[model samples]
Target: MRWFRKKSASTTKTIFGEYCATSSVHGVRYFSDPERTLCEKFWWIVMFLVSVGGCVKLIESTWLKWNLTPIVVNFENQPISVTEIPFPSFTICPPGKISKLMYNFAKEAKQIRNSGAHANAYGSEDCFSTEFE
Candidate 1:
């Protein structure tokens, strides 16, 4: 049984190796080739290093641009007030805010599955009643 598992794992690896050798990506086939010569292998390594260096340079330039650029926020010369902003679209209600007896998870999940529509997991009306506010 152990030998059979090992054989299957080796077969999977062989399939992956075949894919890498046949892939259209440059330098991959050479790198994956089992019979590649020393010179070919050296060239592949050099190509891989150059590709990695180019990627690093690209990321460095992007990082420098992001850091060097100034982000200016204008408040129109007026005091900023939190109340001026609209209320959040949704609020998470704590367990104490909603009665566990009234909320049935299974029933709500079944309703959503049957209807194939999204329903709020928690009842907004019960949780946001005027009394709670």
Candidate 2:
């Protein structure tokens, strides 16, 4: 038997076959190769499916986490020298009844009321602090 074999004209290159052979995606070349055994092809298919499944699961979890989260606006009570904040930069206060957990206006009011010297001054001033739980 001759070691060197002649090239056959019977084997034709189709569009899909050429694409699969030269695909940029990983494992496609080996999976599409005609010379590879059935076991090798099956293994490639399994690996491809596992990678796809992992990617899909990652994307799904991320999407759900992003959507399920509530929009939060955090503010600190640190004293500022400026009486009023300039335009553009501002604080976000919750609408309706503010949660006692976040802030207790009643407690602050009680402290101010107990301070004798400042009691009259605070009582005279028009303040929104009167509306407390």
**Decoy 2 TM-score against native:** 0.43
By TM-score, who's the top model here? 2
Clashing pairs in 2: none
Model 2 residue 66 CA deviation (Å) reads 0.9
Worst 10 residues of 2 by lDDT: 1-10
TM-score of 1: 0.38
Q: Give the residue spans of candidate 1 off by over 4 A.
A: 1-9, 70-133
Q: Per-residue lDDT of 19-41 in model 1, one digit per residue for the tens?
A: 87888977877866879997897
Off by over 4 Å in 2: 1-13, 70-73, 76-133
The lDDT, on a scale of 0 to 1, for candidate 1 is: 0.71
Across 1-133, the per-residue lDDT of candidate 2 in tens digits comes to 2333322322334555677798999997777689999899899989998999999999999899867863433364764433254446778886776776677667677666456545477565444335444
